[model samples]
Target: MTEATHDDRHPMTGNRTDAGVDTGIERHEYDVVVIGAGGAGLRAAIAAHDAGARVAIVCKSLLGKAHTVMAEGGIAAAMGNLYADDNWRVHFRDTMRGGKMLNNWRMAQLHAQEAPERVLELEEWGALFDRTADGLISQRDFGGHRYARLAHVGDRTGLEMIRTLQQRAVDLDIDVFMEFTVTELFRDPSTGSGGTGGRISGAFGYWRETGRFVVFESPTVVLATGGIGKSYQVTSNSWEYTGDGHALAMRAGASLINMEFVQFHPTGMVWPPSVKGLLVTESVRGDGGVLKNAEGERFMFDYIPEFFKKETADTIEEAEGWYTDKKNHRRPPELLPRDEVARAINSEIKAGRGSPHGGVYLDIASRRSPDFIRRRLPSMYHQFKELADVDITQEPMEVGPTCHYVMGGVEVDADTEQSIVEGLYAAGEVAGGMHGSNRLGGNSLSDLLVFGRRAGHNAAYHSMRTKQRPTVSAEQVKAASAAALHPFEVEGGENPYTIQTDLQDVMQRLVGIIRTEAELRDSLAEIERLKERAKRLSVEGHRQYNPGWHLALDLANMLVVSECIAKAALERQESRGGHTRDDYPTPDDGWGALNLVLTLPSDSDSVDLKHQPLPVMPDDLKTLFEES
Candidate 1:
């Protein structure tokens, strides 16, 4: 309800006790250290540990509290439980089409092929999915999937996923540093590691509870820190998703691709101001819920994109038939990729057909039975009942768009998940190119599963085989510690919270869902102002349980990421998927063929953007798209 403040109970800062005046640093060593405790981080740690290496999982929050735990919907995998005709090729085709063909071809192929095995592995490791009559893992329909393809535990799929992965990591004896925030990644070129130039040496950070600096010396680091939704005022993401991994990779000399695309999910709560942007799962619409404007018109049919026209239903009757007989009828427009649905919702509201709460109406009450609603979407029912006091099985809910995911992040090798910066690897939401311009619902969970394992496996091999482990020098650690504590050293400077709020305002107003060149340029100018203010930002409290201090550190990451988003948006002058341009309203073939790449020059803090050609797809894979 209130604006984001330093006083909120922060996940990174656990209960703090006075370690009084003890500034002494702590140090540890590992072959690989995974930063983040979400699904990807846990999976990566487990894999690296299994690969005969010392692995550590460091996180900003307590175990099981990562942003992945908040994911609704389900993990997408073509297990064909509900439809025997379904397979990986179909899943791949759906993904590429959903992403508007800008996705990295190799990554999409790998994700589709490996997702099934990953989901089955989780099932083997005690992840209980809803089962079909034949006892196979039940797959549920989600937007952009051609078949029932999401393996789930009702609507709380992410909670089940994180719990299973967390338990597996614990059973595998992986070391975990809870409530620690990694502020800088250290790369030592002088160690003569077995990679080009310099390899990842280690990470420098602090214990959130004690504020004491710590260092972990390692040959490899896996950055699984999640999305950049915290940069927006209204988001489905938690407070922790402040572009940490993306910023860390950029600062460590990696390039970021397609930084313009940010996904705003179609159905977020739009009432009661406080919970306005809280997510309303796609599973509701997948299960036959309808979207309507204030005039009681099913508005989605009128807003269907030409790209999806051939496969989507044109009438309400045809769309309704799909829930009961998917084999014969086309999917509803409401089931279009998130970008289309979000834009449609925005249009309805802007045209003054919005609900009393300033959003469109989503009604499942008139379609599905009360028992079916409760059984399939239990979390949705409870979320609305408790948070908004509106029983979803009885009436329509006010819903609109909210910033949910980013399709762009650190660019990495499709095969190894290694960024341009040698020993640094990335996967999940932090790695770009997998989702392209727009990500399909349910695809993110699968992306995490498929690539997380790959990143961990390769990072471990790289660490173990390095002739000698790289070490972080005392000087490097001291410099990092000084930079982190600089906010406390400054006096009478701008408040970090003010700079953060200002940055969010600029992003939401100018660089959000729909953008133009002038607005993006303005956003960049504002971001520069914020960056200057951030450098002079001051924090009053000591680091122990100090949310103000944490904000100061996170503000730097947000500013860099915000600039990346705005600059990339400006470079790609066409509307496509998540990166919709108000002026240049159509997708351009030339722009689609090239990606905007952002690299940070070593000599300067500013980021430079360039256009890079996309990789050519293999003929075998190209033929898949030609098939009817």
Candidate 2:
């Protein structure tokens, strides 16, 4: 199929100039521009720079403190002999099982194969992962890993990983633009045809430090802007994960796939309203923590499905048996995959055995010594002590499901990160079909490493091969600049914070872990109202270092992402991994075989939703599956 081109109404075509005009704004040009500075963005910039391309890494936050710092758990890999016979094949099968078979075969294959090297690469770059006596990187069990495959640095794995990448990027002399937000893409002006004109030219954004608009004209733009978990109030993700990449890509005419499949992490802190939804790392359970009810009963064995029944233990005795003989039995009941644990918790809550916080309790007090708990789960101790005044080593932690990751994102070919939009590419959480309906715990970090480098390499290679410098029209920069600055123009009516809060509340209440058509429709209408209110919302201060103004701008992107999610949820007729529809309580085979693709409509208020066929696996896929 041919690519879609920019319409006459597209902002890029309004101005034509062979030599790119700066519009007197802060003009930065590069061979490649990366929109996020997290793990993927840093890695992409490093790769692009190493490939002899001049690159820039732009982020909305301080250097080294991107959303990646908040990632807990660990990076997934398939290093053999962590358990006997454990390899990429087992990791692949486990991931496919966890995702309910909706994963892109090629992406999954690549991830399982390449993740080990990526993790080791981090080690080579000065990441200090906890190691075993044999001198290999120590591995831990996370939900959905058939073996102990997650390589971690205690519980601050993301911090360790991101710091390594950030330091590496700095070491490589990659241009870093901190506190800059890319609001829109610049398209090539020469191609007027629908499919051809959509080539990406550059990007326009605002610099928080200067309080001025900035534009970059680049031959290639890689969007690694991460996931949209902040769309809901109860999320384990950071404030920076506002789905900027997804929204920006959709607006640029790329199709977003599986948007309805948002993964609600099974264990988030459920107390102290301020930090109520912060993530309690899966590493807690991985280190032998147990989930309990108000009556102190272990309950996951009762909820085990037939698929996992053979591998999983049943009673407390059986679970205890595995700790002694790891090879003879599966890990304890608490270490079941996230979806199973979440459903078990939901069932317990419904059965009136929940904790005081309306969730269940996760306790490790009886399982391990205080020193071991303190050393392995330091963040859990610090988080509870600072946020809830509870010592995890001495007390049971209150936990429940909270929106964490989006399994759905821009649909792309597995090997190539190219989206439906020819010039547009996405990787990491911004690109989808790798995790299917639900992602396993540690897979995300590994995914970033594998795909981020691939995207950077491919984008750089493509730009070099084409030798076409796509120009950002002067008019496109001006329009994007005006739109970005419009948030500060509103001086009265609703506050952006209030509108954003309402948007979160609506999404969490109606379109959350479970959904129905009526609830989804209500969410849509409420979102429209929220969007209207957002237009009238105002910021009280100047743009320089103003979080309020930044939020005001982010709200527009959040609203766009929320609308797409709700619309996609409403259209899908069956329950899938992360997207559970009450109206259609079971998964339909027809729906299971396809992915939902959402694109931004010409009228920005509505979304254009479509379905695309999933890849038909060839003989190689069968071999990979069998070996896995």
Candidate 3:
């Protein structure tokens, strides 16, 4: 691969005439419009409504089926009574350690402290978390948590949580605009003249079912859109996880932090090619499953590093001891943090101990009885049975790491959840600086609830205190509509599915669990090629609910975000957390404390990389840690 200098041109702003499509068009309007309807968006809408603002949640899927429904594990919270040692401080420390200390201290601090209240609020709104004999919420152990701090309702935690929030939002009469895809943000032209400059006035998108363009005119817009795992070939993320919010925010000139740190879950099923990369939740390992090679040898012991060495057991006896007496000993070997576990699996495969499939075996059949396994891992049993024709109760399941979550995204203030953009806010996976480099397993759910509500409340407050600048002009709306429709108008030269598949293959090969300078360079070249293909991409059918056409548009966003990741990875010359560059090999102490900011180019598709000074913790904030 050839090394190329970064271009400062806005690739999305090129002339459309070359592609045989018109670019000129009209704009549409809303009071408060949210692009995603997952846990974050639902929570945001609810908070906005309580703040006395009219809100509408526009989503790409049905109410509950958004990716949040697929989150099987649980939400992390500091409901302290479950484990006496577990508190907000411990939670914060575990989060920072899990993220390799690259996290925004303020975001991690706030998330750890406020998460319990959010979880309890869900309970008040009718979420039925599993309860102990004392009737308090039951807690479960997950990867990276020092204590059992995840509140759950069996394996369907996200489903239960989203359902509760959705029901509550309905009771409050928040408008639900399902099957709508936001394509662009509309800034008031008059803002630069007399009003608050650089504030997002509203947003616009197409209604999939109606095949019509819809515009929302609001002083505030909250982006709760999720991760970019869909950019990888083998991922656990749903179609909705296309990094829409990240792309939109970047395009609107909001700074993105830590775009390179993507988390890869250690145990995705790896078998028949069709279901090879589906997520096998950490709940499997949480229930006593061990990672073993085809030789039936457990391998994690050899790979435990100093950071987790004390917290991880080596011998089988020590592992069993740790499981039984977790407080006195380390966590069970099976429950090591995700990055460690994934690296262990990688070593196993590299050393020729891998299973028939290019993956290792995660077996619980030998550890637990079939009846107990059936009761606890019903979904795993059913998933393998339906998708791969295998049953976990009867056999060892093959598993490997698949791209799962992005630890990087739009930068936001820890307390306000506001992006650098004045009227813009972000939460959930789209907002960054919380997880840092590697996210703990259960923290994501809690982060969404905690920060999502904060974003909503803050956005509503900004909306109430400020006035709308000006309505979007007809020329602006027409241009956006034309741009939204361009892919459909082009004659067939490229298939979106083919382009997407190629893009994913490139990402998986170059930016997978491991990385090197050579691979990173190759990945950047591949991204540029894919971007060229995307420009000529065409789709079958009209602007109606056409998945193919929608994918074409999504491909552009994914490519842009992927480029940001590659570029950021290239700039960060250290191996801290998820961004382990073989060439760099070790973390730089001076660089470790800084945040990498990827600012969008004023005229092009490339991102400008710069190191921003991390915020220092004040005495009052430091005191919160001491109190805990």
Candidate 4:
């Protein structure tokens, strides 16, 4: 799979370096270029091909190995397998409420309506989901859902989903360029691919292995490059999530919305420093796990959901002494209630009642039988035993907050998924307005499929309808190539890894789950200072397979995105959904109606923040909220 396009018309090598790209650089042409081959990118490519477009998928990692594989929860869709009364309307209502009503109603509506079809489509493409006694695809309940709506393959649903999508892609012969890092997106290229006067032109990147440049000229581009979690010090995301898509969209002149809304999962592994921040899936709590602080007290009774507090509040007094009883841990059991659990752990840690590793204790050992633990959670059992030397059936696991996903990203048209830049599109975690302020546990997979299909089909149609071809700017390509190589040219300078670590620390501490204006302002100052120092980062080795050079390139993206998060968090002045502002402390009605958008102007290096009115939900849709 070395720099080659797979198709009937192309050679086995498949690579078309002959596109006359500035000698030595490989170049090719396609109708649509889909970057980031995660679930969304793969789905988008499949959709583009079905819409009669020659599609190419460019990914930072090998195909089927995108961060989507790390997803532990099942895909959310109202299939009605387990719950006969479940339907799209109910799912839509749950999604809107879960996102605290900041979600674009149109996107949420479409996602809810189309998710079931997408799940079935995956099945048709050879995905094998766990089935019920009736032999229909099994659905499980997740946080914020009223019924069993998630169709899963145990907890490894994401891995299976990717495998199915990847195999489907193989059967379709969609050209996949694996291990390619796209550093720059070229808009309106002038001297297009290889002097081929009327050639496809848009993207410029490089192979991670050889370090040689590669360009793809396409009329339509879909950015499914995932989230900005890697910018934080503690995260469950992989190394590739350095906000490449977010930064590329900004550079391509697209705006980002809700940049401050980053989701921090409640329980990431906190022991054995080497495996810290690894996600201890919510399933542990779902299948009976208890949260305790250093004082050996089971503390969930203190943090039940506000809605259920009245009924459960009185029981708290009765349940207080029951902490001595092992079987009583699951008594109040409103389910771990993700938001409340995270808040409770943070509170304990802040009060210095945390575990030795600075996290609350999630004990499943005394509550569940060893056999039940192994049967229900094979992954969790091994994840703890192998990674941290902690046996879930024997001991409590240290858990804390770790950045998981971002609800903020490139704002796009609800239906078409196109960005401010006409042909540029985004989906999955890279596209916002769908998840709005906060995302539900299983909604991420559904969002990827629903918007991925829309983005691909629409981008392909946009390509088909265009009368004049857009060329990639040669100057932009040359400049991008130069920037990729500059670190090797520097003599004495800062180390990219050091700068990246510092940036992550700044983001994790200041612009994290809890925020304040002064901390955000200080983060901004530190980011600006890092931005200046990053200009002088030097590489110890040549570009070929050089990790240092990669970080140097990624540093710019992390810096810019960190700036966006910090600036947006600073401006919002209110706590809502995933953006928790310590200073403001509560959601403001005015802020609820307005979305914060950050756009990078070509003339300036800094991003400019502005407020945009959220699209009004139609009367018919608004009535759903008013209804029971």
Candidate 5:
């Protein structure tokens, strides 16, 4: 993408517009405004409307285009379709263990207990999930689950999820503002209604299509924006995942927990450069695929962690038996949680056992019939054929780690999904403490449905019962507008794209999967430098369909988030779940009990990190883990 010329344009001015694009500031009001259009946002909006509130859904992309569609495995829920022994208690135990027990116990409990209902609700709302012999929704296997517990629509489960949620939203008549990017979340003036000094007032953003500013005056705001993967170069996240919600919450005085826990999925494509980091879903392994290195040997058995050794197979024959008879044989090491698999892949590649493309091989062709592969993993077949000209039905695919999701985000009340800031709520991937450290493949969809509904229900209730609604202050809007136009105001400044590239380089090289003190510290120092460089950024073109200008706006958010990750990574010395430290190399008991939470005080230039204790699981819940 080439930069546009200045060509006699005035700074901080966007009066002109191309055909079919609007100009000037626009305003609207709603009882609740959700600042994303993913599974979480759509579910939240529907809940708000059900509660008799006028809701609005604002998004950076068109409806049904949120990164939720990128999910391939399925929506996880212990629906007991295949295994009558499967239940919420077992699901809860699997979730907690997969996260290395760092998950908020209550949140995990709620997610496990409510996931089945949520999936069934989706089916009722017209999600076309694959069915079993008895016509029940099919459940598939995924890493870390005790039973086959993913409700899926073959490999296009995420697509069907977003489609169903979007249609449900459309049928409810909820308002939507597509292609609007929210840059700043606003709050009431100190002297405000209901005497609540820091209640949510509204949100501010510009239209990507029209380059015009729009404001929504609302009493409550739900931040359902997804992960922070785009901050890294190699990622499964779409272009939209720039840590927007995480940064927005921190900027608005909310705290983020476990900021260092970044999940790198094990099976991203690693070929042809262009689609190198694209996701190759966990379903490949869930069905029967094995990981092999250059020696054509299954390498996962050599890297199984002690934590999962009890349930994982040590022999190839036992592991193979699991595909056909799960009750008698142990699961394969290939079915270990994502962190272990990704790290094993990294180890193999580092030891010169990598594929020609610098990754390992995921071989499903040798295990399953061609028809079974196509019927189950159709998306994987098509993605491979079109992108790399390698047919998955005939050969193994080159795969490696890619920054996929962040377990860290806005810390919220486990039950209500409300942040410390009144009227500001978060859910789905944007909320912290759900998947403590490493997330299992299918649980993300379940998390979206459960907590998204909680956030929406609470936000709507809060908006309706509050005696008076706070008004957005003019001063706040002016400050936000100035910050938004910073890149344009500076003359002869550095290019925003250059800053983005540099930021990605630093993150991928230093703060990525395997981190160290020196690397994280160096990352922080570079982040500080990048922040300074970002302030002087310049974009030559108007915002209307300007990818360069839009990215310029997303730069500040990325910088703040990268700093949070680096600082948190530096603070936690021991390895656990997603945040692995090369120096420390193992989990520390004291560190495991504690969490690193970061917050950005409005008056401060730097974020403050503090040690907080993880919530203790209740006695009744602890028994679930104790049972063999």
Candidate 6:
């Protein structure tokens, strides 16, 4: 993967160095470059290929190992296999409500309408979902949905979905470059006839295996690099979720919306210290697990938010009865949206009602039979047993909130998945405005499929229709390569790992699930201090498979994204959904009227915040809520 430093006659490594004299960098061309290998990236590449375009997938890890593989809950789709009355409208209503009415109406509508089709397509691609007695794909209950909408393969739904998509992509012969970290997006700089300011031209990155530079030149680029969970100390997200796409898009002049909202899932393993932030699948609660305090009381009923009072049961009897007779009784308080449940767990711990490990008890052992538990949630059983040395079938597990998902990201066109940058697009969690303030338990999966396909199709069409070919100057490539190698050149400086860990501590302690103006301001100040440290960060050893260098590059992205989150959180004083401000503890309709948008100017390191009015839902879609 080493780039050729000299022009012409440079030894051929069987890779092109982008159309001309090579600076020794490996270069390739494609109609579309999808910068991720997860579900969304794979689906986007597949769609682009089917739409008559050459596509390549660049990922930070080996195929099939993306964070999407760690998703335990099922894909939310209104398949109605378990409940005949369930449909897309109900799913849409639930999603909008779950997001606290902050979701893009069009995106929510399109996701609900298209998710079932995408799920069925995955089945056709050989995904074997758990089936009902009638041989239809089985659907299960999850938080925020009105019915059994999540089509799952037990609790390993993401693995099955990714495996199926991966196989399909491999079968289609989509070009894949694994272990590559894209550091910079190349856009046209000329403001003349055809300037790069509006469109993306290519991407510059390094192969992780060899630590050499690689360039991907494409007419269109799709960013599907997932979330920013790694910015926090405790998170269910993997190492790859380091705000790559978010920061990359921001650098390329894209705006991020609703950056204040970050979802802390209610059921992460909170014991043994080693696996403190490991995700305990929501399927555990969906399958009748109840949240109890140290006092052995079902404490969720005591913490139900006013917004969900009408939908959630007030008593254990009604809550328990609803599982069997949903038509007559409201859902259990434990089955409330992740934000509400996470806040409740936070409150309990603050009030001295938490378990010995600083979390609340999530018990399914006393409710569901052992056989049923093993059959339904094999992964949870094994995860608890192997990771925490606790058998979930025999005992209640200590669980608490862990940073799970970011509801804000690169703002994009809801229908096409294209960002404000003409040739740049985003999908899955990287794209914003789809989930709004807080995402439902299972909608993340469906959001990927629905928007991934749209982004791919539109990107391909744009690529084919464009008359001009965007250029990536030799100077731009050299600059990218130089920036990547700077950490190695420094003789003495702060360790990248120390800076990252310090940044994480700042985020976890000050800008976490519950925040205050003072703490957020402190976090911003800490981020500024860390930014200086990051500039002086250094790493030992060569680039080849160097984890330190990798973290160094990731640190830059995380710093920018952390600033965006803290800044937005500070501006939005009122508490709503995932962004709970201890200082301002209630939702404010006036604040809801506008989304806080973060943008980075080309000339400045500072992030500018602006208020973008929330799009009014059309009367037709608003009618659905009226009916509810």
> Who is ahead in lDDT, 1 or 6?
6
lDDT string for model 1 (200-292, tens) is: 899989878767677788889999999999999989999899999999988878889998999999999998899989999999998889999
Q: Per-prediction TM-score, please? A: 0.95, 0.92, 0.91, 0.92, 0.94, 0.96
C-alpha root-mean-square deviation, candidate 4: 4.9
For candidate 2, which ten residues in a row score worst on lDDT?
Answer: 1-10
Which residue pairs does candidate 5 place in steric collision?
A: none
lDDT of each: 0.87, 0.82, 0.80, 0.83, 0.88, 0.88
Q: How close to the true structure is residue 30 of candidate 5, measured as C-alpha lDDT? A: 94
List per-candidate RMSD values in Å.
4.5, 6.0, 7.2, 4.9, 4.3, 2.7
Worst 10-residue lDDT window, candidate 4: 321-330
Cα lDDT of model 3 by residue, 369-421, tens digit: 98988777777888988988887887899999888888999989899888877
Predicted structure 4, TM vs. truth = 0.92
Number of clashing residue pairs, candidate 3: 16
**Candidate 2 regions off by >4 Å?**
1-23, 192-196, 310-327, 623-628
- 27-123: candidate 6 lDDT, tens digit per residue: 7889999999898998999999999999999999889998997787899999888888889999999999999899999999999999999999999
Tens-place lDDT digits, model 4, residues 1-628: 1323322222226544553436566778898999999999999999999999999999998888899887766899998998787899989998887787889989999999999999999999889888999899988766667676888887788899999999989999998888888988776634323111222347888878767787788888999999998898889899899999999989877889989988888899987787778887776765667778999987776665555443232345435322111212223332433555676789889999999999998888888899988876778899889988888899999999899899999999999998877788899999999987888878989988999999999989989987777876667678988888888888789999899989889998888888998999999999999999998998876666788888899889999999999999999988778888888987888999988999988888999999999999999988876655
Clashing pairs in 1: 1-274
Question: Candidate 2 or 6, higher TM-score?
Answer: 6
For residue 202, model 2's alpha carbon misses the true position, in angstroms, by 0.7
